[model samples]
Target: MNWNRYIKDYQSYLRIERGLSKNTIENYGFDIERLCLFLEVNQIDVSPLKITDETLQQFIYEIAKEVNPRSQARIISGLKSFFNYLIFEDYRNDNPLELIESPKTGRKLPDTLSVEEIDSLIAVIDLSSNEGERNRAMIETLYGCGLRVSELITLKISDLFFEEGFIKITGKGNKERFVPIGKFAQRYIEIYQKEIRSNLVIKKGFEDTLFLNRRGSQLTRAMIFTIIKSLAEKVGLHKNISPHTLRHSFATHLLENGADLRSIQLMLGHESITTTEIYVHLDRSFLKEVMYSFHPRK
Candidate 1:
């Protein structure tokens, strides 16, 4: 099959079977497109079904020069998945990337903000502006719930369950989880909903969306990043903060405060405990304290 047909089929598989997000499907498609581009540039003619391991390795070698190890690893993983899909369909007898190894890149811990820094960042919001309340509420919700930017943007008004102390989150693969929202976050959201959001003319089909832009449309992920970047600059914070920074800080702060990993994982919507264990590396002293306080020998 042609590259386009293969990619389209793969995308359908990801969406229908894997339930991956659009961004994830696009990323996987981009990896294949990169391979196609390389093949064209090198005057090589090969279909996805006919591509050999040697040719794939050559493309990877060329890609290594242009991207970091982390990106290279992602590309390799994406390509491997595509080839495995082909194998699953019986289009190919064996996978091209089966023997190839991903580059060794050590686990990079996420950057986290201190509680004071978080407070300082939120304090810089211009509360007098119409969006001020919304911004504060958004930041608080982000930190309080440990939500991804995508989840935050798509959050619906119906998802808030303040009376029950929980907010429902639709995480990766469209998996839903109920995270407990703090009193502070709930209060700010109520304020924004009653005062700021109530004043706006919400567009059709977005009436249920909790957070919105001034145009009454749902907020974009880029807008969320821009908001955080502006707040970080206003506070003179040297850290390169993003929406994810608040999330990491949420997890880190909880772990440091003696919250269990499993609970944090549930709140953070991490499917694996190992994903939550990274927070342990953030504070060795906290781990030591836990050991000393809880160990029977001490």
Candidate 2:
């Protein structure tokens, strides 16, 4: 059988048995696919069972030229899982990736913005333009609810449970979760919906999508990144900011202000508390401040 068939079966196992999220499963598939492509390009006819440690290491070395250690480590992990699955099913007698070590990586904290910086970025939005309101709403929703760019783009009008102060987010793997929508995000969406979105000649399938381009179609992820980058440039707030940065900032700010980590995890739609624990490292001073301020008779 071709490698792609095994890959398809592996993806299904990830989805059904492992219960991994869509984005994660895709990442897993992506890692394997990269190896498959590399092998094809080199005319190497080695099957998964036939792959040697030397071959895997050579592939890793090639990948290291483009990506950082963290990305390399992640890909290694994904490939290991794939091989382990094959071993489990008796398709392979041994795992080729078992001897490969994941590249060492330090825990890199995410960049976060202060409340003032976030406000400055928002303040520069030109309210006069047609897209201004939509842009504002987009930023607001990003920071307001801490949504991933994918979630923000896929946000639907009917998903708004505003009466319950929540919005249904279709997260990784199409997992649905109800996240609390802050009043600011809610109000901005309301404004955008009434003022701009209401008048657009929306496409049939995308009629329920919250954010749309001027052509009345769903916005692309690149478009969202461009919007954020331009706004960051306009304000001259110097930090490597993306839509995800806004989200990191949102979660960081909440954690700094003493929001419980579990709640933040739920809001961010993280499957693992470990993923959410990164926020704890963002604000060390917050921990000190919390202890000093709240400790009895301090």
Candidate 3:
């Protein structure tokens, strides 16, 4: 019905106008599709244009029992964006969710690994295997550049500017930024390329893709997560970690070493420095140190 048409058109707007990633567009679509399913299953018979906030609140209340507050907040946010888009297209005069507020999930700090822990995780890789070198290189790059898993997978050989010591990253919304690469990461990547990766039969479309599966295709995000998970298990590292943990570690380590928020924001490809501040939490000791070192009164 109108649900399908509106979902399609709104997704197109997100893709073409907003330049959002495929995953983000799919999530938005899922949120709308879920609302439609709720209406259908309950015999509510409402369309996107005619749906009320009261009905949405009811749907949210039902789902809240099944999901956490963070997820509930995200669903509310997605629905709000969809309605806002409909209003922008002149389908409605006002947003249905204008008055609805998302539940506080609190500012959950990202998990980070310390330098020794990161080294231990990477060092446990069985280097004799072909994937071992590749894994080592990938982990080095992940922490070195503070790359999101998406950015890590899609990194290209051409993006390497080793002489300039910078690797170009295509972040969210396909926005490009250059992040510095240290010699430690560069060395491992070069070793992987020269010793391990080059031996594989390159697939047609993925010739320039940096990280690859054993089949020589571009690596998936799931595969990257699996690699990190397997390593964490092997090393007896108890913390629930992922590729993002390495990224958070990168930013946190930089801040601990006296890097400023604006610099970390640029390096992490964040649009706002506030996001960087939230992303890399500082301990009380570090806060005291910052004040002692830089404050005018100190």
Candidate 4:
């Protein structure tokens, strides 16, 4: 099949069978598209089933010169998955990337904000503005629930279960998890809903959406990043913070406060405990405290 046809099928498989999110599916497609672009630019004629390991290695060599090791590893991983899918479907006899080794990039820890830094950032919000209450509620929800930016934007009013003290989250691969929402976050959200959102003329499709722009639609992921970046600047904090900084802080702070990794993992919607273990490395002081509190030698 042609590259476009193979890509279309792969995308459908990801969405239907694998249940990956749109952004993830797009990323996977982009990796394959880069390979296709390389083939076209070099006038190399080969189908997905016919592409040889030498051609893929050449593509990898070209990309390695232009991209960092992390990006190179991602592209390699994406290609490997694509070829594996082809093998699963009986389109290929062997994988082209079977022998290709990914660069050994160490696990990068996520940047987190301190509790005081979080407070200072929130305190800088202009409460006089029309969006002040909404922004405050958004930030609280982000940190309190440990949500991804995508999850924060797509959060709905109906998803809030204040009486039950939980908020339902649709995480990666459409996996659903119920995370406990703190009273502080719930209070801010209630204030915004009662005072601001209740009066707005929400758009047709966004009636159920929790966070709305001044235009009365769901907020975009970029808009969330811009909001957080502007707040960080206003607070004079120079940590290169993003919406995810709040999420990392949420998990880190919880661990520091005596929460277990399994509990943090569930709240953050991490698929594996290993993904949650990075927080253990973030705070050496916390580890020292834990050892002193529990170890016999201490």
Candidate 5:
């Protein structure tokens, strides 16, 4: 089959069988399209099932010049997945990337904010503004629940099980997890709902959404980043921070405060304990503290 037909099938498989999120499917599609564009520009006539490893090596070589090692590695991985899918369907006997190796891109340690820094950032909010309480609640929930920006935006009011001290979060791959909600975040959310959101003329089909823009609709992920960036500037914070920074801070702070990685893994909805173990590197002191507190010889 041609590239278009193959990609369409792959997209369908990812959506229907794998249950990948739209953004993830788009990213995978982009990688395939880039390869197609490269082949077209070079006048190379080869289909996905017929493409050679040499051609793929050429594509990787081309992208290595344009992107960083991390991005280049990801593109290689995405391409590998596509070829593997072909093999799974018995369209190919071997993957073009079978012998290829991803670059040695080291793991990036996530940046985290100190507890004082978090408090200071929240303290600078202009409480008199119409969105002040809403913004405050959003940040609190982001940090308190260790939520990804996507999770924070898609959060629904009906998901809040305050009596159970949890809020249901739909994470990557459409998987759902119930994360604990601190009283600190719950209180601010309640205040915003009662004083601000309760009065909005909300648009159709977004009635269950927890956070709304001034236009009375769901907030975009970019808008959440803009709010956090503006707040950082207002507080004169020096670090380059994003919504994910709060998430990293949440995990790191939990590790430092005597919480186990397993617990943090569950709260952050990490599918792998290894993903949650990165916080162990953030604070070496936490290791010593854990050793002394729980070890028999300490």
Candidate 6:
């Protein structure tokens, strides 16, 4: 099959079968496209289905000069998934990336915000603006519920189960998890909806969407990053903070407060407990402090 047709099918598989996000699927497609471009440039006429492991390895080696080890490794991984999909569908007898090795790198932990830093960031929001109430509610839900930015923007009014004390969060791959909502978060959202949002004409497709931009459309990931970055600058906090920082902080703060890893894992919608265990590292000092204060053996 041609590279274009194969990539189209691969994207469909990622979306429908694997439940990957649009950005993730697009990245995978870009990796495959880059590989195809490299092969064409080098006068190699082999299609994706006919690509051999050796040729794939050569392509990776060529690209390694331009990218860092970590980024090169990610590209390799994305290519591997593309080939694996072909093998799974019986279009190929073998996987080209089966023997390819990912470069060895140290486990990089996600950055987190301190509770005081979070408060300081939120404190600077100019509540007098029309979108200020909405912004306040958005940040609270993001940090309080440990939501991915995608989950936060796509959040709907129907997702709020306030009477049940839970908000249903749609996570990666469209998986749904009911996370308990704090009263603080619920209160702000209510104020935004009833006081601010009720009067605006929400855009058609996003009418049920909880957070709307001034244009009444769903908030984009860029907007979320913009919101956080602007806030961080205003607060003069010298951390390279992102929306995910709030998420990591939510998990880390909970772990520091003596919440078990398993409970944090469930709330964060981690498919693997190992993913949640990274935050456990941040709580070590707190653990030792508790041991020294409360443990008789200490």
Best by TM-score: 3
Candidate 6 vs. truth: CA RMSD? 12.0
Clash pairs, candidate 2, are: 22-173
All candidates: TM-score:
0.67, 0.66, 0.67, 0.66, 0.66, 0.65
| C-alpha local distance difference test of each model | 0.86, 0.84, 0.87, 0.86, 0.86, 0.83
Q: Which stretches of candidate 2 lie over 4 Å from their true place?
A: 1-106, 294-298
The sequence of per-residue lDDT tens digits that candidate 3 reaches over residues 174-228 is: 8999999999999999999999888999899999999998999999887999999
Model 4 has an lDDT value of 0.86
Instruction: Give the distance in Å from residue 289's predicted Cα in candidate 1 to where it truly belongs.
Output: 2.2
Best by lDDT: 3
Q: For model 1, give the 10-residue run with minimal summed lDDT.
A: 274-283
Give per-residue lDDT, candidate 1, residue 125. 96
Which 10-residue window of candidate 5 scores lowest in summed lDDT? 274-283
TM-score of decoy 2: 0.66
Residue 30 in model 3: shift from native, Å? 18
Model 4: per-residue lDDT, tens digit, 35-80? 9999999888889998866578678767877988899999999999
Clashing pairs in 5: none
In terms of lDDT, the poorest run of 10 residues in model 6 is: 274-283
Better of 4 and 5 by TM-score: 4
lDDT of 1: 0.86
Q: Model 4 Cα displacement at 295 (Å)? A: 1.2
Error (Å) of candidate 6 at residue 186 is: 0.9
Tens-digit lDDT string for candidate 2 (16-132):
998999999999999999999888887878888677654675677678778998998898899999999898889987676664556676433446788999999989999898799
Q: Residue 186 error for model 5, in Å? A: 1.0
**Candidate 4: 10-residue stretch with minimal lDDT:** 274-283
Query: What would the C-alpha RMSD of candidate 4 be, to one decimal place?
Result: 12.3
Q: For residue 23, give model 2's deviation from the true position in Å.
A: 32
